[model samples]
Target: MRAAIGVWRWRRNPLRRTTDLVEAWVALVAVALLVLAVPAAGWISGTRTDASLQRAVQAQTRQRPVTTARVVRLAEAPAPGTQSPESAGEQPARRAVVATWSAPDGTTRTGTVATRRELSDPGDTFRLWTDLDGRPVTAPMRPETAHAHATIVGLLTAALAAVFVEAARRLVVRRLTHRRYRRLDRAWAEAGPDWGRTGAGS
Candidate 1:
């Protein structure tokens, strides 16, 4: 009730009738939705990397070898200087996740994940490496950071619902505002002393 009265008062004010403002709001929502979809892009990239790594691991080991192993501690990336979080910054991050892993050879080793991007975590099995000098290294290539396919589809549905809801809101607001103005205009038109007066000459 209070909201209706508030809108009634607002309808009397002509300043709020800017179609440009309404269009701007729609544009803003669309832009926000676009940005929210960025995670989907990242998921795609991760999927590709995950597939490639799966193929690589399958080739070397007889068994699947449980790709994602937990890092008992932070581990360095497999390649030197491959992990640098500060791509936008002047200097790259020298150190990555310092963790431990058990190699396929059954030897447990500890290293840091010094890759460009943040790689796997503790307990994620990955392809291990060693430099010419025999320094241990590991990089998180395959990170299964994806929800079920249904979940992705559901997100798209939700996004479409939001758009329709916004459109409906705008439409309702417009009709209510138009009704308010017609009521006010009719009242003003009948305000003249001669309007609706008892028949004088009739």
Candidate 2:
């Protein structure tokens, strides 16, 4: 909070021109937004690319020779464990796969589909999702597909942009200093005359 206050105060530095401060403020905001948006954009791009890869794989799998094909509803439960007929001991496991598919009408659907689970019941929609290499792969989501990592390059870009903006401001100070020096030089050349040291005042 104190830092925020300090920043707010710094934004209003009286020593700086209004235009310079405004430029600095705008550049700072733009750089900050770019830094924040890069990771999120990367995540989205990765997920989209992954989806595309799955589609390519699925298309290739469809072209391959198949032993059999069956349509069943997707489930969120694991395959049932074999139980001894003499003993009543059976347990059901739960595991889901993330699935998505396009329909005949060009509509897309995505949901959690069970992997190796029991056959789907009535009205259960089922679709296949494959990997990039045309193999019957599992879910569409990858461990790192959604993982966003901030790297040194992103930070450096923002830092460099900010530095450029600040450097632009130095030009104004340079011009002001040049004018001040010219005034001082003119005054120094007339200093003796003003003192009437050699009839200069007349």
Candidate 3:
């Protein structure tokens, strides 16, 4: 609909310039890409993202296992306004503590793990995730979370694509306008030398 409105001059306009026809074609192409190509690109991006996330979810689920750990002692919480190197980018809601758990092979292992609750004494049990070596690990990725991520990625990709199309359209129009202006200037210069001369007006 928009393309039809934009290209109306090309159908039957006696006064239309070459620039008008070129711009009408450009507008039609831009509209086609915005309506068709943009959505296709977004869908492809989102599908790829979802597939990659699902693969990661599978890998993490296979490598990490849930286990119970006994807290040997609570590590000192970070000082106010300061963060530990290990806790960089991690939420402050959880604190690190020393704990011990048994691996799948029935061998005992001890390490520092993050816990939601602050433990004051030894032997306090807490739920934890561990790798095959009994080392503490982050929880596995959820499918719902992956879906949300994919949705955001798709939306951002579509928006960026639209912006690019708009920019390209504006660039083409500006170039066309400049060309028209240069042609007008040349015509005026050629005609200026004959102004007011006999038979020039005729």
Q: Each prediction's Cα RMSD?
A: 13.2, 14.7, 3.9
lDDT of 2: 0.46
- TM-score against truth, every candidate: 0.29, 0.31, 0.82
Positional deviation of 128 in candidate 2, in angstroms? 22
lDDT of 1 by residue, 70-122 (tens): 34545434434533232426234333566555565666655554432334454
* Candidate 2 TM-score over all chains jointly: 0.31
On TM-score, who's better, 1 or 3?
Answer: 3
lDDT of 2 by residue, 1-202 (tens): 3334444766758775454455445555545544565455555555665566556555645553222113344445532322223222222333344444543334554544443344344343344543333333333333333232223334454566556545655565566667767777898887945774666656
lDDT of 1 at 63: 35
Better of 1 and 2 by lDDT: 1
Off by over 4 Å in 2: 1-9, 66-202
Candidate 2: give the clashing pairs: 75-114
Tell me how far the alpha carbon of residue 164 in candidate 1 is from the true structure, in angstroms, after superposition: 4.4
- Model 3 residue 135 lDDT score: 70
